[model samples]
Target chain A: MDQALPELNNPPKTRRGARTVRKLLDAAQEEFGSKGFHEASVAGITSAAGTAQGTFYIYFASKEELFRTLVFDLGRRLRDFLTENVDETTDRLTAEAQGMEAFIRFVRLYPDLYRIVLEAQFVDPEAFRLYFQDFGAAYRARCEAAATRGEIRVQDADAESWALMGISLFLGLRYGIWEAERDPGPVVASVMDMIANGLKPRPGEGGTA
Target chain B: MDQALPELNNPPKTRRGARTVRKLLDAAQEEFGSKGFHEASVAGITSAAGTAQGTFYIYFASKEELFRTLVFDLGRRLRDFLTENVDETTDRLTAEAQGMEAFIRFVRLYPDLYRIVLEAQFVDPEAFRLYFQDFGAAYRARCEAAATRGEIRVQDADAESWALMGISLFLGLRYGIWEAERDPGPVVASVMDMIANGLKPRPGEGGTA
Candidate 1:
C-alpha cells in the first residue's frame, strides 16, 4: 500500500521504511482530522507519529501534499476494504448489501475518513474530485458487468452507480456517523428493501396492515 | 427568512434592513465561497456587498457567526425551494422527481452551497449536525405521511427519506456541479425509474428488450 501511493517522494523499499510511512500517514490522519488543513502542522503530525521531524521530510514534501496523498490513500483503503468484503458474493444485490455493511463498519473504525475527504474539497478540490470520480468509475464498471450478466436490472450504468453511491454515502453519514448507538441491521434492511422493491407500490401488492 | 435565523444577534425589522441583511449574506457567500473561512474577511464581504463595514456588525457578530448563520440560511433556503417545487404534485413519486430537479437547479444557482455546508462540518460541528438533522426529520415525516396515505410503498420512513436524500445529493453533485453541460432530463429519468422500479429483474421481464 505504501508503494502504491505516488505522492511519496521516496517510496518505501524496505519493510522498516514502509512501517515508518504507515505510521506517518496514520498520525497525519489524526492531526489533519482534528486541526484541519490550515491549523495542522508537520510538527504536530510527526509528534503524533512518534517519529523524528526529519523522517516526515523524507516522504511528503509539504502539508498540502500529505493531505492530497492521504485523501487518495483513504479512498484506496476504503475500496480495498469493500472489495474484500463483497467480492465473494455471487449476487450483485447481495454483494451491494455486504458492501454497504462493510462501508459503515469501515467508517466506524475510521471516523476521520469523512473529515479528511470533506476537507479535501477545500484544501485540494482536484484531489476531492478525483477521489469520487475514481470511485464512480469503478462502481460504474461493476454495475455494467452485473447488468450484462443478468445479476441486476439493466439500466444506465453511470447513473445507477452514482445513485447507489449516494445511497450508501448518506446512509453511512446518518447511521454510521451520526447515530452510532443504533443497530445498523434495521437500517441496512430498510435500504436493501428499497433497492429490491423500490418505493412504488406494486399493482397487486397491498400496503402494510 | 430574516426572522427565521436565530444566529443573527439582531434580526432586521424593516424592509430596507432586511434587504441590507440579504446583501450581506449574498456577499458573504461570494467571499466565503471564493476564499473559504479563514481567509475570508468582513471587509471583503462588505466590499462585495457595497455596504459599509459597520453595517455588517448590525446583523452578525463575527465571521464565525456569519458562517454559522449562512449554513442555516442555506439549508432553509434549499428546503423552501424544494418544498415550493414539490408541493404542487399530487403523487409522492412525482413530487420527488420534481423536488430532485429543483435541487439540481438550486445547486446550479448557488454553487457555493456545498462548499459552505461542507465547511460547517469543520467550522461549527453543532450547526452542521442541526442542518442535516432538521432536514432528515422533516423528510422522514413527509415519507411517513405518504406511506400512511398509501401514496408510496410501506417501509421505514426514516431510512427511506435518507436514501432518497442521498440519491438527490449525489445526483446533484455529479450532474449539477461536476458536469454542468449534461442534460438533467435523462439523469432524473434514470433515477425516477430506479425509484419507481427496483433493480431486480421481474419474472417475465426481458433485459433491455
Candidate 2:
C-alpha cells in the first residue's frame, strides 16, 4: 500500500517527488470517497495531502484523471494482494475461502474501496469495465485451470467466474464494508460451504440441523 | 410495465390525468437513464412526454423527487414481476432458477434498471440503502424458509442470501444488459448448475468432464 507511483505517466524523478504523488493519491481517495468524484476538489485533495494546491498539477492534470488513475491503482494493487494470498499449492476450495478472507481483509483496510470502485462506474465507465473485465479474465483462468487440475467442476468457466466474483463482491460489501466489525471467519466458511457443496440437501441430512 | 401511477403521491383522478402521470414517469425513466439524474431535467421529461413543462408540476414537484419516485417504482414493479414468476409451491432450487430468469427478463425489459438503481446511491443515498436493505431482508427470509423446510441446506441463510443476490445481480448485468442479444437460457442453466451443485468435483467425476 505504501508503494510509490511507478506507473505514473510522468515518473517522479526524486524519492521526495514520489512521496508527494503518493500523498496526493491517498488524499484524493479520501476526498473522492467522502465527497464523490463530481463534488471532490483538487484543492481539497491537495490540502488534505498537506501539499500546496499547485503541487497537485505536478501529479495530475485534473480531478478526473486523478480519479481514473486511482481506480486503476486500486484494481492493480488489490489484484496483487489477492494473488499473493492464494498461492498455487492450495486446493481450489481452500483457495476460494482464502481468497475471500483476503478480499475481506483488503476491504477492511481500505474502507473506501466500495465507494471508490462503484463511483468509477459513473465517472469513468471504461475504467470500470476494464476493472471487472480484467478481474473476470483472471478469475476465469483460475477456474479453468482448477477444472483442468481436477480441483473443481463447472459448466462454464467464464460464467462461473462471474458468479464467484459476484459472491465475493456482495459478501465483501456485507461482512467487510457494511459490518466491518464482524469476524469474517464465519462468513468465509458459510460461503465456501455453499460453493464447495452448494445449498442442495445432502443424503440423510434432511431438515434444519 | 404499463401499470398506472397508483402509487403516486397525488394520484390522478381522471383517466386522462392518469395517462399523463404515467407518460411523465416513463419519460423520466428515459431522460434520467440517458442523461442521468443531475443532467436530466423536468423540461426534458415533459418534452419527452409531449406535455407542457407546467404539466410536470401537476404531478411531481422536483426532478429529485421524480428520480426518487422512479427508483422505488422500478423496485416495486420488479419485485412484483419476480413474485408473479416464482410461486410459493416450487422447490427452493427450482425457485432460485425461476427467480433469476424472471429477474433477467425484467432487466432486459427495463434496460435502465441498473443505471437508475445504481445512480440512486449517489443521488438519493437513503433510497439506495432502503432498496438493498428491503431486498436483502426478503431474500434472507426466503432462504430461512427454504432451509427450515428442508428444501435446502445452508450454513448461514443471511450470508447465503447476499451471495445469491450478487449472483443474480451480476448475471443480469452480463446476460441481461451487456449481451442482450444472447439467449439467457444458457446463462440461467449454467448458473443454476453451479448453485444447485457447486464447483466441487462430484464423486466418480474428476477433471474437465
Q: Tell me each candidate's TM-score.
A: 0.93, 0.92
lDDT of 1 at B112: 89
Stretches off by above 4 angstroms in model 2 are A52-54, B52-55
Residues B54-168, model 2: lDDT tens digits: 8788778889888889999888888888889897688889999999888888888887867899888888888887888899999888888998999998888888888999898
lDDT of 2 by residue, A1-209 (tens): 37746376676788788889998888988999888887889988889899997778877778888999998889888988888988768888898899999998898888676679987878888889888999999888888898999999988788878988988887887778878999999988887888888778999997454
On the 0 to 100 scale, the lDDT of residue A146 in model 2 is 86
Model 1: per-residue lDDT, tens digit, B1-209? 34344346798888888888988888898889888998999999999888998888988889999999899889988978887777644877888889888888888888787779878878898998898889889888877777777777856778878888899888888887888778787888877887878788778775442
For candidate 1, what is the DockQ-based docking class?
medium
lDDT of 2: 0.85
lDDT of each: 0.82, 0.85
Clashing pairs in 1: none
> What's the residue-level lDDT of A196 in candidate 2?
87
For every model in order, the fraction of real contacts preserved is 0.66, 0.76
